[model samples]
Target chain A: MSEVTRPTLSDALTERMLELIRTGGHRPGDRLPSTRELSQRFAVTTPTLREALRRLEATGAIEMRHGSGIYVGADIERLVLPNPNMREIHAAQLLELLGARIVIEPPLAALAAEHAGGEELSALQRVLDEAGRHLRGEDAELHDANMTFHRATARMAGNSVLNEVVDSLLTVHGPEQREILQIFDDRRRDYEEHLAILEAIEARDAAQAESRMRAHLVDVKTVIEHRLQSPR
Target chain B: MSEVTRPTLSDALTERMLELIRTGGHRPGDRLPSTRELSQRFAVTTPTLREALRRLEATGAIEMRHGSGIYVGADIERLVLPNPNMREIHAAQLLELLGARIVIEPPLAALAAEHAGGEELSALQRVLDEAGRHLRGEDAELHDANMTFHRATARMAGNSVLNEVVDSLLTVHGPEQREILQIFDDRRRDYEEHLAILEAIEARDAAQAESRMRAHLVDVKTVIEHRLQSPR
Candidate 1:
């Protein structure tokens, strides 16, 4: 175990190669550098290079040949990729994300009305109940749960695009959100607002559901903005 | 040209390898079979395998080493991504793309009333005129133009998330959209409706703008449902 220093020369070399391939426009059926060439260039042992290559192969980057070199794969566009080294968002970027949600969430609610089955609705019912409970000083971190409740509604919408977008938005609650949402600290008012929206949905009134959702979102936006303007 | 006699053995081998990666849950850094090993398994000449591997490498799948063997690359997960593959209703998907737009557009108009720059509203004036022309029988494909017109409005909202969600919706409409919509063929009425909404926005009347947008969406949905229930 002591001899195994974490991620030896081979690991680093493999990472370098992967960076090269990704930056390069290698698509499915593309050929790679020969084994002898890679080992020579990276100044690593053949066995170590081979191990690293194996790891990449297992991860679905390329296909190996008996006598031939490795080839690339297909449809490499849909994966949840990370933009790790991105600079911080400007106010412009934050506004953009909010604008996107404004467009995306309504149809999401509509779809929820259309596709959500009993089980999905039941789960949402629990979220609503829990949110109500949380509003009344029951949970310290009600913000997280409240966010989850909205996410649950999106999931029931049965549209993968909506699901992914809403999910991504919820995961990164920026300073804007933390600053803006202190208004929810009032348990009674918040719970009442939530109940009105859920009750409208439970009644199977799509118009009412949509109406309530918009109003609620507006309220949220207003609160968030108010918080931004005022210091703690 | 004479040497290219068959369906290319390299191509066949590469496809097989892609299947293995997507289905096999292979990760980055995996090693590929050596030339000798692959040649024996696939019963192909080493040169042919090399051709296939080259293609794969071009696609960011595998890399070659000088003394070492081939290693897998990162970004493989993105290589064979999952997506809804419905290409038939490309047009309707475009309309459904509008489904998301209704959410952002009216709100955007209201926001513009409060926050948009003078330059922003001025840029859209030409778009409004063209839309009016289309409504008056200038062209049949105004429906398509109409969608873009609304998208531009969202852009004016100065919200990034709003823009991203709406655009992402358009991508999905690449296929699986035509089946969902039927143009009412009442271009005159539809165009007039558009003008009403646009006029409300220009006047900075947020309530009127919002009401016009909501009413327009309801009208469109009714038309869609009616068309579906009784199609020609």
Candidate 2:
């Protein structure tokens, strides 16, 4: 007999899979067994197995490798706290987390501005510029570019904790979560907002950079609220 | 013979024990094996077993029945993230976590102000008063009370997702983090700052409250930076 019996199949497979991934049993780049094999062993149908896998992918847990196979993702699991049950709006939680951000990131950006070699800044600059190129024209490419700049800033900070947490923010908006960008008819405003924040960071004006980054998130919040009111 | 075997006897016991707790293989609150019994069953000495058992208990993975026997502990082990790792200031992770906080929190406070009710506001009042009592006198007590007041406000916001995030922030504070409170010579001044922020919230002066909070945090940031600069 195998050292351990397989996990039982159920509607909660997605959650169980997540539990496995988060608990470190599933390392990045570990290939999952084929869906057929997994289903047969777990006594679940192929469709059921696929359903859980789909959600996992959506959350950036596992990636589909096309002809290759499904594998655990690298560095995708960021410091996302477990969500509380949905009843309250969790405002203070929001404020506390935000307060911490304001205190930390401005310094990181300032450090980046002073220490990041030209190559790093240019890479970030390129991301901002590319995001500008497709504003309101198309979203997927622009969104990716925007993320690249944020990650680049983290890389410049030389802090893994900072880098991982920022990326985790993007994780919350994982696959299809980007449907939020559709809320604004003229997302050019948001792009311009990003431009202001980046420019301040580049200028090594830490305070201005923090302020603009915050100002930009205001639009983001507005867009998020609108999208939630009537999903696309 | 027992089917379970491992490279190390302690490793096998740890695995079996976690499986027992997580799978409810043993009922909650049920007393577990004595060290003597565990050592005999696993063919390991008491010290090796103690090391494994200690690891589990430290993580809240299990509980000793207090001169009784070991039992299953609270399910802190269920959490996906290791908060202790994320909270260390000297370590490199704080900045990233803070970045995520920035994006989600300011609006949370504004929303909390918009929605916090009488009972919740009254609770905040009580916590503030209690916190004020010890602010200048005992540093440890003051930090605890101050955190209580802050947490009370978040609890008032009634948002689960936001609250969960805030809980993470609480876990990140330094073990002797309260020692920094002495940096402000007159604790009364800090308490008054807290009172002003509370009043601002109570009066529904969202702008004033937010302004006060940001200002208070800026002073705190300077103190913390100064402390970090000093010898450990």
Question: Best by TM-score, which number?
Answer: 2
Give the DockQ (C-alpha) for candidate 1.
0.07
Q: Each model's TM-score?
A: 0.49, 0.51
- Model 1: docking quality category: incorrect
lDDT of 2 by residue, B1-232 (tens): 1121122544466676666554655645666777677668767765556545644553455665444667776433222222322222442234333343333344455555777899888888888878867755667778888777666655555554345455556555544346446554557767887788788778887777666765665655555555556835
Error of 2 at A117 (Å): 6.3
Q: Across residues A119-197, which tens digit of lDDT does each residue of candidate 2 receive? A: 7777787888888887755677877876676667756866555555555444434333245465555577877876776
lDDT by residue (tens digit), candidate 1, A97-126:
554555556656666776778887787778
Query: Candidate 1 chain B — worst ten consecutive residues by lDDT sum?
Result: B78-87
Stretches of candidate 2 off by over 4 Å are A1-119, A129-142, A153-165, A181-232, B1-82, B86-114, B133-141, B154-162, B182-186, B227-232
Q: Give the docking tier of candidate 2.
A: incorrect
Q: How high is the lDDT of residue B170 in model 2? A: 52
